[model samples]
Target: MTWNYAYSQDLWPAMISVASTIFLGFYSWNRRNVPGAKAFAIGCLFAMLWAIGTSLEIAAMDFSTKIYWMKFHALWQIPTVTALSCFFIEYAGLGRFLTRRNLVLLSIPALLVFSLMVTNNYHQLIWTSFELEEYVVAKYGIGTWVSIGYANLLGLVNLFALLRLAIRSSRSRWPVAIMLFGQISGRFMYVIDSLYNHIFSPGESVLVVIGLSCSLYAFALFHFRVLDPILLARTIVIEQMSDGMLVLDMQGHIVDINPAATEIFNRPASSLCGRAIVEMMPSDSGIEVQPGKIELTKFEINLGLGDAARYYSLGLTHLLDKSGEALGYLLLLHNTTEQRRSHELLLDKQRVVATLQERERLARELHDSIGQVLGYISMQAQTAQNWAVAGNTGKTVPILSRLSEVAQEAHADVRESIFSLRAGMESEWSFLHALRKYLDHYHTSFDIDTELLLPEELSEDILNPDVGIQVMRVIQEALTNARKHGGAHKVKVVFVEEDGYVIISISDDGIGFNQADLILEVGKHFGLTFMRERMTQIGGSVIIESQPGSGTTVVLDVPIGT
Candidate 1:
């Protein structure tokens, strides 16, 4: 059957579609350079191009004949698909700087399917021949069973491309689902019409139906701005990337530096850029920047903060022009001081732990062997003294003399003290130092009032280590608990040793809940449970008291005398 050669109501839609699409294409292109107006203009242009191209194909062909329209439709359809694909990527929030890598990757299945169509219809290319209908062109090429197969294959590939964009956009919170939706519905109707006409009876007019569908889709696309969200999201994500990126001109001036690079150096991009990186980096950092090549340089640049001693990994490279000559430098600054510090800290902790373990072993051996022997010797000396005082003069003389000799040996062992294991006067100061050191917040984010009440002493003791560690842990937990649940502002902390007990009070003035159940279920919070376990090992207890409005107080008490 042949479609009638007339500009009917059905072709009217195609004409309007083409006109609007071309108008959008030009307007969008013109506004491309406008900041903030780019995505909208681009989307309009995409729709416009598809409309204009499809319209021109229909205008040249007889709409009522399947064979004629089919012959030329592929040429028009390809550009529309290309435009849609580009629109999908941009509309789905890949940003204007979308990598060529991803684009090539997505084109694979489309290329393969197009290849299959060409291979199957060897003499006819992807589309074999055309059948014309009223206001539409339908292709009838493949043999009956293979016709279904080819159509299915085409459908799958088109759907795949669409779904890929939809999923990527979904992940980024950009609602480009409409693009996927429009592609599937518009293409599916056209495919079904071709298939139905080829093997079965002539059914619904696809172009007329799809033209109506496209009108609806275009309406939805332009009105709801269903593909509009991706552009805004691109703005947000680019503002948060790890590596430093700077876009510059032909001169050796700076364009921009991300937040990470700003922190790596002392100054913001506003202050540092356009002023040259030479004045910014440290003199001793062994960095020398010149034009025309990429350079990997290490630097000890002082970021003038509380942590002024830190260093960074400086990556300086020339921004190349199309011909590979240096236009400007793209400097990437990464801080490596933390990595170095962390490595050193691990080694130091390992050594200290090993030394402590060795001392523990020696202390155990001394207490078991020499201490027991000394106690036995003292017992024997007392026995001999008793006999000497009982008036067996001649018999007791040898015994009394031997007792004195044995007593002197016992006294020598007593003089050989293991004070290293205990908290000496120096250990108190060391405890304070250690506690203060642990409390140090490096790149920390928390809001809480911390106070330290320590004595005037530098000492070390086994009981002190045990008590001090448990007390500090309890205070840490209490502070965390207050911040998490109490909703309080002021927190008071106190530490003291009296009556052979080390006592600590961590109180917070916040909305204290009657967490009677939570206290009962303290074993649930692993941190809290571990804390209680730590205190228990040191012969201590952690007590929590709270009332709804008043606030909360946690007291950790440890017995020093065992």
Candidate 2:
């Protein structure tokens, strides 16, 4: 392997190509973080290698030195083509194809071509023969044709990718077009040099084409910012949004729909477009789309029947042109199916808790009232039996009489408990309405006159369901005690608002008791204890005003917003 050097006119263009490619390689390497930039840098490196080898081959005087350099330059062409193909593939947003397995597959042909070029001296598979005139010329062999075909295959793929990108992107069209022109011109020059070697020598052609291509690449990279990320347009935003979007013409016909809308409707865009907006809605959706009738509207809609139904919050607004003229309507549908299901589940859990609470309250009432009464009756019967057996008939008769009275009171308590358990507010019934109904029933059942007084500005919406139920139970207990224990003939219930509080006063025309006796009486009478506990649960308080001779009054102090 003897080496020799001589001056040649081709050296200038080859050196220029080397410098230009080296600059492009480093420039692209600086932006390697950008998509496709690393691959482009690698391609520039291979192009630089080809330029260096071509320059050395042009300066070599001996045929043997020239042939060796030619082989080196030819070997680099395979890798350069492969690297550029990878760049275009990534730039076209198809980088998924560049998996490790696919990269290995892509490199197989380059490795095979390299092996054939290296062993060409033994088999002459790359260049059958070489002739040295002013430039080294070679006759192509089967291996050379194979390498050419493989390179052209990759070149076509790169061209298709760039062309697709140019067509699809309006903002990057100019940059893509410039790169496409560079690729086409480089390939065209190679083809011309291959066909007409007398007019265009291989070394000069390769250097000139590499320099031209690198200049075009630099222009696209610096002047047009080709490697920078593309800004999202309104259409791109609409297309990629999670919420479904529909654009309808002024006549309420669908003009365009995004992929999300297509998925929501479970139909293709072609079918959805040119159709009336109402035609796609479920029959019971309750959505009315009247064009120009309203400036903006919103409502919830159910799209399917039974368990498969999906809920969406649909918003409609007029799409206006720059001149303020109504162009069409923009319908935005946000899926709320999960939220609706969550709300229903929450209500179910609440109902379970309410039912459990009601059962516990009933259990407490039975234990405090009926359980104590039954125990007292059992003890009184045993005492009466002992008195009768000892021949003390006078004491036994009074004990038996007292037992009968206790039995009657227990029966009345049972009835009252049943009534309280059965009393409930209907969905449409207000707290005041339920209270009035209970009072009417009490008057008819007990023959006790009842009167209700309410403030004029009282609102039914003031009390929530839980507060209303607790208040009603407390009032019922007070009215029952006024009749049974106090022996009241008439009751007056008054509702008055004072200082952000609703004070309920129940006055009874009944025998009064000493205020000092309430502590001892509360232990014996669970009704009074239960009333205080109920009010306390709802952030309220109960006060009893009474004397030995005057009528009694029960006052409840309840906060307005509780």
Candidate 3:
């Protein structure tokens, strides 16, 4: 082919189209990793090629050179339309249709048209005849009409995708509207150029007008951030998060929910949206979801029953607009079932440890007190039997009386030990109430009168449960000593709070022993030792006061908040 080039008025518009398209092509290419950007870049590049070929065809003076450039321009037209169609489909969030197989199928028509246009010399199928007039004119053939129809069909699909997107997404409407206008304007210019060439042709290539219309795409891209990945990233994060998320309106109705939220409620998003949140919650959830009344930041709720039970920590957050006006609420349900199970297991282990410790203490008490007393009684009985067999009644009588007294003391100790073993705090009873109940039971069992004097201001909340148990044990020991050792008829237990300490006094109207003699025998008295040890374990102290003629008093000074 021979080339003869001459500049025409149409060269200016074609050159402008080339520059604009090349700029958009490079811009789109830089954002190729974003959804739909690669296809948009391909479309821009082909549009640039069409502009370059049309410029060359318009400037050529001979029919043959003009025909060659027209064929080149025609070759890029189908690829441009196909690429833009794919971009629109992807932009509308219909990327599932753009599979590799579908892309290959879409390209087949472009390839067939390209081959026919390239082989037009042998078939004369693309253009039947060419004339060199004021402008180079060509008669269209069956192949040319077929390519036009296919391009038009692709354009219609692209328009439909954009229109649907504009209708569904309010935020995306502006950009989609711009793109739709560009596409429709390009198609309209093409139709006007083809049908009214003699009367309305402005001596400019139709490619120039189409390329200018596509510049609206570049404007939308720059102004609206059409290729930004922020929206896509947000959607992915929300859908894939492990924590269930719900977006609710000011009326406490579900506006939207993530996939995790759907799974948590065992309902679809379509079924959940527009329904009241309280209706969706479990009946026993105890969640107050009355819009402005939902002040709870974190709450635990149980769903299901038995082995299928799940625990969740629901967190509420207020959604506000820029003006600080409340828009809605966001509910985040985090699964805490595993954490709850672990806590229960720990409590079980603690209970086991406490039970073991209690058993060890009981064994020690038996060994230190009852066991030793029983052994002494056994030795005395043997001695008395020996004396009686030898006919020595004088020594045997005194020994038998001592044995009777020791046996009675041992019996009282056995009863006290059994009472201590059976004592436990019930969940519903307060410490003071339980203590009074125990005193009533003690009076009935021991046949001794007991009086409890408690301070009116003293509350059960001040003492720890573990410390309360030890205090009760110490009180029991004091009452037992009053009856068995002091021979007391009546006892009074008094409680007083002073200087951040609770002072409990257990006084008995018994024949008291000398304080000096009691000090000397302190190591032999297991009850006193046990009481002191128990009080010390709970950050408290035990004090005993007595005189030869006065009553005995056991004083407990327990520090508050221990």
Q: Highest lDDT, which number?
A: 2
> What lDDT does model 2 reach?
0.83
Model 2 lDDT per residue over 46-95, tens place: 99999999899988888899988988988888899899899889877678
User: What is the TM-score (0 to 1) of candidate 1?
Assistant: 0.33
Q: Please provide TM-scores, in order, for all candidate models, with all chains considered together.
A: 0.33, 0.59, 0.65
Residue-level lDDT of model 1, residues 95-192, one tens digit each, is: 46446786575456445544655464465534555444443434444442343454355446545655654443223223335444555676666556
TM-score: which is higher, 1 or 3? 3
lDDT on C-alpha atoms for all candidate structures:
0.53, 0.83, 0.81
RMSD to true structure for each model, in Å: 24.6, 7.9, 7.2
User: Model 1, residue 119: what's the lDDT?
Assistant: 62
RMSD of 1: 24.6
